[model samples]
Target: MSWKPLRVLTPRSILPALAVLLVLLAGAAAHANKPVPFGDRVAEPGGADASPVTAQSLDTAGLELKVGPGLEAYDPATGEHAWSYRREGATALYLAMAGEDAVVLWDDGLVTSVRPSDHEVRWHRAVPGLAEWLRGEGETGAAQRSETQRKQLAVERAAIALYTVPEASPWVAVVTPGLTMGFRDADGDLRYNDRPAGNCAYDPVRTVRTNYAVLVPRTCTGSGSNNHQAFGGITGYRLDSTNWQLATGPAVAMRALDGQRVQIEDGPVLGSRVFDTKAAAPESACGSRTEVFAAVRPQGTCAEPVANPGP
Candidate 1:
């Protein structure tokens, strides 16, 4: 009997299939290790005071947020909750103090003022169909607007921009979804201030040094052109009383284009680069750089100069 020579599989085809299988397995393993957002992990904790008042308010003296179901409140330095209210149905969107009253707006659109010391419902109104409006079930949906009603409400509510004039002030400005501008007074009353056309973003990320009481919204629109220029300065709102407007003249602009990967040295980094194109123009150069942390593509060449110790 003649013995036939055994054949070995070629490395090319086998390696690709093995790589694909390994990639899928790696993806599955990574997915299993994903973390949940902080908000989802905890239940909304309700407050002790459950009063029913017509109109009330509280005085906030240096406080942080304490959340609960359809309710949120500010925990003052004295450990007493200043503002407490029930928003939506078991989902509290926001909690603010208007005088001694706790102003609450839930996901469902029910706005109510509750006595903080004694959880009393002072005044309550279902903004026509706010709950349905929020859930996207009503005819108006998310973008529904009642221009006359909005204007009237603004005047009646005494809404002010949420930000304070000085960085030292304890005042906070809040804007209702209906575009109502209001300020919470030192006594914590939700009084209508003035209305501005532009929208403002919350500084929850703490990216800016300004204590986010309220800020004038700054927007930069860029067509997807390679000609990206940096704004020369940082422009902020020049607050006049309860109102806020952008400071005139240009401000130092940071490049905000997406897909921007920047190189950082070993030490602290003050600014960032949005993309390789934007990286080309630097008003200030980074100090003598250290090594970068990146993996090269398999069988790919390094596009930029790399660090090499001289002999």
Candidate 2:
């Protein structure tokens, strides 16, 4: 696995996109603001409010995304409205490709899979919110306030990531403000509800998602009295902290590419390397990185394996 420079994902701010099917689970409160129909407020393509929509629109071919008060999808070739999905106050948090679809995660818990070509909604579903996840925490009002604070912190201090697992059919990791769960992207079926990594939280922030695994920027906070220490960056534990990397520096950038792989840019020295998380081989002999992901260039000569060509 000779580490080579390549690009697969987009910067987190833009939410990387691919020419495939898109399944997005964006959170929408039951009592959300009044609907803002598409075209009623088509953001001027490159306005401040349209930043989120711009990236998706440009990256995805044939799909025109107009996001302002609402999100609308149009057929660029025909200049026709294929479909329009809008909610008053929901933010487009994360986006990634999953096989023939793109999986998106929203601040609220609404998930919808839409084919960009024909703009057909294959499946859509909603998940629980932080307040609902912690239903047993405190009074309803207090719980809602607590969840709000966590969300604010997530925006200011941490990042939200959307990860897609193309294995066994596509499944999207729905990381809400409370828990991390997996849902089949093909349909809106719940695949697995994940446990909070030992002392760290996967919701709101503190957790990062890559195609192969979920990385937790582990901390004692959000563990709810766990009080135990945990790994810092790029956690290797299936659900618990078993192995790790980037113990000191700040969190790195990562994005999902097609073919069930992830490209991570650690720093200038490392440049960027696309890891074959699906590679069925012993880990790279040089970089003692996660055994499953085989990449990361070394300073010296080491045993390197053939990497599956990038798409």
TM-scores, all models, native as reference:
0.31, 0.47
lDDT of 2 by residue, 3-100 (tens): 88876565663444532213232223423544543212222323233334323443365566543223455567875655554444665444556676
Each prediction's whole-model lDDT (CA)? 0.38, 0.48
In terms of lDDT, the best-performing candidate is: 2
* Model 1 per-residue lDDT tens digits across residues 1-311: 99978777799759999999999999999997776322222222344353322132334434444335534345655555454444323444445554444555544444554554545455543443344434434334334646545433322232222223223333344333333333333444445443322332222111121332233333233322375532212222222343323221222223222222222221133433211211222222332242132122112233555679789
- Assess candidate 1 and give its TM-score to the true structure: 0.31
Q: Model 2 clash tally?
A: 14
